[model samples]
Target: LHGKKINNHTANEAINHGFALVTEERRSTGIYAYLVIGFNSLISNIRNYKNKVGLLDNSRMKSDTQWVIDSMRVKTPGHRTQIGSLSGGNQQKVIIGRWLLTQPEILMPGSYTPLRA
Candidate 1:
């Protein structure tokens, strides 16, 4: 959390400092499969979408979600599509996109089988 110690803060609060993690058991922990891709894409950084009066900035959320879809090359019909409909790899892309949207200073992705790169 930059130079600040984050010992007492809640997990969500820690996100404000641009730190995120993608866990090992992605199927169990990473995604809300029944939810739309748009929802999943923005959930991590959802608080940032609020307006001064606390209304959601839907257009911005959509735009960012689209950015994630396009940039990550996540093969989905659209943002409204359910995440469960996608293959495991594409789902992982969406999960990664969610954290990338936060412009994270540090990202820790857990033990997924490493790809040949």
Candidate 2:
């Protein structure tokens, strides 16, 4: 009821759907790669755009996003680096960054973490 063409819970519902555990195939191909991008960038980007408060508050968003990638020990020379070129562990971090930025009430990495520890 927010708008004639709008649904307030639409974005929230979408993000919830995105919170899943997926297993990547042993070999990489364009189709699998597209699935990765869909799960990582699309959901998070939509949530952020819909939730922005101000440019100032956005400071934490940027930092926290980078932090998730760093905490996962991704070899991004810069935070803005494209996630596609990274090794598998690093690529997982990018997806993690997407989820962490949204600060979802529940997060399930679902065995994607390749680290031994």
Candidate 3:
């Protein structure tokens, strides 16, 4: 952060420093790809894509994904399903789980209002 605005240019840095965002646009390309790939590969990519660091091995990846699924109560057949196929709430849960994996310092969720009964 350091007083700089969080835009595309600063987003990566913010993420590295544990900043995350969840927007109403949950069906974005990245989220869709993440759903297709499943959590293990997603965590692997998150670790290696930007910094070429391997934070979690296969065992750890599975463990972490399970944790997320359990915590979010995401009722699905493991992490193999296309997240897009899930209901919107489940999809949001997956996205939230993904951001939570980042261990962010600040989490900004946008335009998420619960339905009124």
Candidate 4:
């Protein structure tokens, strides 16, 4: 990994080549729109489309999302429940699934420390 801070171009290149990172803040409440936005929307957000036709591949998106969910064991209401509503463990799983959707060759997850009651 590069020692210096990564710029947008480097970050984009890394993502395209299957590099992903998961922060310790697992809730990621704002990204709870996974159900409504759909997996394809999320994937396409990182892609640079040459034309409009390349952007509307709904079937592929559905399958991709399903695969990630299954692989990550992220249980949800399938487009109904907000991801933020899930428990901490489930939310972490969802985050992992989201990164897996990118098909990363390398994944960097931040250290996890449970809160002490």
Q: Which pairs of residues clash in candidate 2, taking residues 3 or more apart in a chain or in different chains?
A: none
Cα-based lDDT for every prediction: 0.87, 0.51, 0.65, 0.58
RMSD of 1: 2.1
Error of 3 at 78 (Å): 1.3
Give the CA lDDT, 0 to 100, for residue 111 in model 4: 67
Q: What's the candidate order when arranged by decreasing lDDT?
A: 1, 3, 4, 2
Number of the top-ranking candidate, with TM-score as the measure: 1
For model 3 the TM-score comes to 0.72
lDDT of 4 by residue, 1-117 (tens): 445554447867768656787777654532554454244225423453223765655566666666656676666777446665666666666566677666676788876544222
Q: Where does model 2 exceed 4 Å of error?
A: 1-11, 14-46, 49-58, 109-113
Which residue window of length 10 is worst by lDDT in model 4?
36-45
lDDT of 1 at 48: 91
Clashes of 1: 0
Distance from true location, Cα of 42 in model 3, Å: 3.5
**TM-score per candidate, in order?**
0.88, 0.51, 0.72, 0.65
- List runs of model 4 lying over 4 Å from the truth: 1-10, 28-30, 33-52, 113-117
Give the alpha carbon lDDT tens digit for every residue of 24-70 in model 3: 78766336643542652254125643333644466656766777777
User: Model 1: runs farther than 4 Å from truth?
Assistant: 1-9, 113-117
Worst 10 residues of 3 by lDDT: 36-45
